[model samples]
Target: MSAAPSRPVCILGLGLIGGSLLRRLSDTGGPAFGYNRSAGTVEAAVADGYDASTDLSAVLERARNDDAIVVLATPFTALEPMITSVRDLAPDCLLTDVVSVKEQVSDLVRRLHPRARYVGGHPMTGTTESGWPATDPALFEGAMWMVATHDDTVADDWLDVAGIALAAGSYVVPAADDAHDRAAAAISHNPHLTAAVTATVGAGESDLALRLAAGSFRDGTRVAGTAPDLQRAMLEANSVALLNTLSETIDRLITARDALREHGDVAVIVDDGHRARRKYERIAGSPPEPITGVRIGDARWQEELRRQAHLARVWMG
Candidate 1:
């Protein structure tokens, strides 16, 4: 079947991710608008000739009328109220999100707005910046934007959600909510924690240590510069997965420490880490396999899409 027509989009937050999305969709001349709680943000977007407002109710009402896809781009802590608004104002809208945590947001939608056709999404892209001023229309370009799939996921809704990601120049990776959370914990969330710790240690050592810090330290601690509240919300929302991943990471560090103390060698940790880094480099440098021939709305569509995602495939549809 052919892909669904690009639907009008209503983004619920106009922060970095949401603002960037608004800019992107507007740049492409697609029907899109956004709501920001901050009037200043609304004014800025308006000044840029984008349709944005501080009125959540009006935005949702418009979405309901237009059958727009409502993207929740707010922080995890802010999701409850934003979702409640979607439930109240646009109960039948197609819902998706860019929040870092998938399972929690999916649960919130299921619990609060069961009537909404929901497909959880998390774009694996961002900088250590927040708000509209930091927004870049090209932020999601060449990024992996996970369009979540589940047993109950509607294929058409999934396609609608993936359409937005594709229009923003992102590759769509279909994944289940729990799988997305677990993988995100390993690659994204845990690394934030480690970056924080690394930055703290380097800063606490001495001014001289920080002064001498170069590319390695800067690259390692880059995400530690992300807003602390944002970091906490992301890490805590996926606390279980983050804890498990953190434990594994801590074990590796302890093992390395012990090996160094006992044998004056850290070869095991070094070699293993080196191999893992090389594997990452190889995969990152390679092009993703394109997924095709899978018909949406088929009985096993979600399963097959997820399988392709696990194999590092991209589905443009």
Candidate 2:
């Protein structure tokens, strides 16, 4: 991977994801540049000691060539226009995005930039926050960063996306564009909508319920507070897959409701949920028993160690 002298990493949007990437890029001894559409936001990033610009032309001027990597951290809706802008203004940079959906983006990149080196990416990590101010440098740490590409995407292009993710403290997962969308719909998209609904229900409840809202309620519906525009964009952009997931979710909910009403065994549902939560905790919180290679950049010690532990536990017993 190239450092500052090779090709700089340019982030096109300074949202939470983009800003967080910029923060990590700075530590890589690379020339990291940031650009946000809003002047005020750009100024804020600049004040934080990043090379940021509100002017697209300036960002393009500083970063132009195949060596450069331009990460489009914009929303899915803004992707096309940003790609078109890059096409007309800047030299071909390795194009990538941090958008949640992948299949639609993969198709769009293939159609719009026929020969462009593009890979679709989504880091499955974020808070219910927005903008640069909400960015945390360690946000991607231990998160699963999924990367997708068309059939023709080159090895180097894919690695570049994965490398960036790794640098941002994530483990990489590769998938086909369609597979990414379908899986993401079930895990990320629909679940968020469910969380929002849960939150809404709580909000509409009596004051007593509001006061009684505890860990389970708060934890389950935490994502409901996510930036409204961003959440809507993610759900709408991947509506086909999301709708399918939603239908499945609805069916499951109905089954649970029926079980409760008919005096059917509800322990099965509760047990499943309890087991799933434990599995989730093991994945997210268990980062290998003892993290080694603390100073190594290329060795994925943390992820590898934890994965080995998991495999041992599953296979040995």
Best by lDDT: 1
TM-scores for all predictions: 0.97, 0.85
lDDT, candidate 2, 13-54, per-residue tens: 999999988877776676688888998888888888888988
Model 2, runs deviating above 4 Å: 1-6, 149-151, 288-317
For all candidates in order, the CA lDDT equals: 0.91, 0.75
Stretches of candidate 1 off by over 4 Å are 1-5
The true-versus-predicted C-alpha distance at residue 254 of model 1, in Å, is 0.8
Lowest summed lDDT across 10 adjacent residues in model 2 is found at: 308-317
Clashing pairs in 2: none
Across 1-317, the per-residue lDDT of candidate 1 in tens digits comes to: 12223789999999999999999988877889999999999999999989999989999999999999999999999999999999998999899999999889888988898777888899999999999899999998889999998878887888899899998888889999999999999999999989989999999999999999999899999999999999999999999999999999999999999999999999999899899999999888998778887988988998898898888888976
Task: Name the lDDT value of residue 113 in candidate 1.
Answer: 85
